[model samples]
Target: MLRAATREAVALTGHLLRYPSGIQPEQITDPGAAPPPATEGEGTGAPPVLLLHGFSDNRSTFVALRRSLLDNGWPHVHCVNHSLLTWDVHEAAELLGEHVDRVRRTTGHDRVDLVGHSLGGLIGRCFVQRLGGDAFVRTLVTLGTPHAGTYAAAALPPHPLARQMVPGSDLLGELAGPTGGGCATRFVNIWSEHDLFVLPAHHARLEHPDLAVTNVRVRGVGHLMLPVDATIAAWIRDELGAQPTLFGAAAERAGERAGPGRPDAAGAA
Candidate 1:
């Protein structure tokens, strides 16, 4: 375990060194404006997939996974890098709503797919479940997101967003509420067994009586790796590419992937 953690840590260091290159200039532009060149790509009739990163992370994390998507017929892939200084999930949800609208308009598609990692997953969920984002999201795939708050947040330095992730915060209280039964958006929650930052780790699973969720268990992968591992990325592309599930009964491929390595940078969540 020690050797594996060391290897993952080194891999993350390489990502950090190259992170500066992945910075999107458009993040400084108005959120209401159309996305920049980074969001541009050819369409293959597949709904555009928007990649959302975790807390304090940028679009760089999804480079490998995004390439896998674009290479495998999921041509129109976009990413949203929200301000790291932001405070509340509710506010971030609103920002996500605006961006989702822009992505739809920019791609000329009414509905799109979402793949959010860690905190990105919660932000996407808050938008879909709280802010009527279901109308715009066709398939929502979260990678290692904490649907219920995680004890991992307590280990981080206190911040507003981190506080909201403290297991039973008021914001989580809102997420704990009953979701509408009529929500048509398909939810695929892909969580890793080796994600140490999610506390008990199972907190990443989304199990609501009202929502039909496809929970995929990934083995031997870490929180940060969920967005980058090649094998898992292929699985994600296949999941989104699969035909839509009808009558609110999406065929659940409830299983695990034997992905490589273990959890990366604890601060990534």
Candidate 2:
């Protein structure tokens, strides 16, 4: 079953990549120069982790991370659904906060650990910075998130959503900075030297006081491959401090590493 789930997730990601959202620049309305205040941490309950995907991607990009977390004893994993039409990064942050609240209400958890990949990471960072998600966010992990503007993003059509991703775009500039950037949650940035999207590699670093930012450079990985990499998953699991019992027959293979297929993390079929 775990194998099947993993396969399904990979397939889903492929489907998402086939249809990139076409956001027009005319439709993008910046939330303005003043970003929303950072969210305050609350004692709602133990925060569950939320997974977000990048542009031209879907929630399935987190399949490996989700499986690793579950294997390490984290069962509460959810995702964000940012509409394809929305080009405003600030608005995306707000919508993400609403989903975090929804997860809290459903699971009775107070805070959430946010895991985002690529553009999704930027969106999550904005949530903690502009929206009030920091109040309910315990940790923020980003895989291949371009803290600075990427060459590929600059080359994209001048869509509002595309412009927001540029290094100095109003939204990107707000979230991309020396750690803390006025955020109130733990932050982790994971990147690959061979990434096709964010080239030169240095664009993925985040340094701030309030944030525990770690710029991990991995070899033999690409932008799309980083999020699902087993080594990367294990690194995130260790950072989050979760450890699950690898039990049953499936556990044998699951122990191969934090990459995928852990029985304890998935339900028995």
Candidate 3:
């Protein structure tokens, strides 16, 4: 536990250097029409993956995780950042839509995968659920994301982004409510027992009736370590490689290292 906390503190220092990274080009808005997914050799068959950082953070949060995916077999991986200055979640989602479209055009992939941490996860979910992004999102993975809203956010009322994350906020209500097409995207919601920003912990676990959500319950791993932990990175790599129908099997694999005091924390199928 001490080790994880120490790393989190170390990572905080890097945040200063990584703030507001991964800015998309303005030309993305007028990036012409979309193309089809690339086949083998042309960046491989797997869809390109996008990583989003937490509140006040940047793409550097994914330095380790991104390398792991690339070293394995994922050919195309991109890290996108949302600014803290953004006033509304809805606008962020809209901008995310543009970035997604631009990535699809660049990689020639019709659909892509998304992995988000903290506030980034919520924004990604808003794009997928509320902005009709499910059609192009193959799988959505969230680490320590407050899917049900977090009281921790209420502490920063001055930031509109923070206010939208408060429990029972209007934006939160809209996301929780029904979407017109239901949840077409495959969801892997990873919530750690060690996360404190999520307030009451359980809020990090998503329980949506319409979504095919695999609520992964992990222990000991802190919020900041989610993107850098070796084991978690391996699990996410495997999960992304697995077929959508085999999500249950992947969930079980997430806790394959269970032994002694560290019993399995796998989620229900």
Taking all chains together, each candidate's TM-score versus the true structure is 0.83, 0.70, 0.83
Higher-lDDT candidate among 1 and 2?
Answer: 1
**Which 10 consecutive residues of model 3 have the lowest summed lDDT?**
259-268
Clashing pairs in 1: none
Candidates arranged by lDDT, highest first: 3, 1, 2
Give a tens-digit lDDT track for model 1, residues 215-253.
776666677767877666766776687744321243344
Q: What is the TM-score ranking, best to worst?
A: 3, 1, 2
TM-score, candidate number 2: 0.70
What's the lDDT for candidate 2? 0.64
List the candidate 3 regions with Cα displacement exceeding 4 Å.
1-3, 14-36, 40-43, 243-261, 265-269
Most lDDT-accurate candidate:
3
lDDT of 2 by residue, 99-176 (tens): 777666656556678889888888888888767677888789888888886768878767787777776777766664
Native-to-model Cα distance after best TM-score fit, residue 240 in candidate 1, in Å: 1.2
**Candidate 1's error at 221, in angstroms?**
0.7
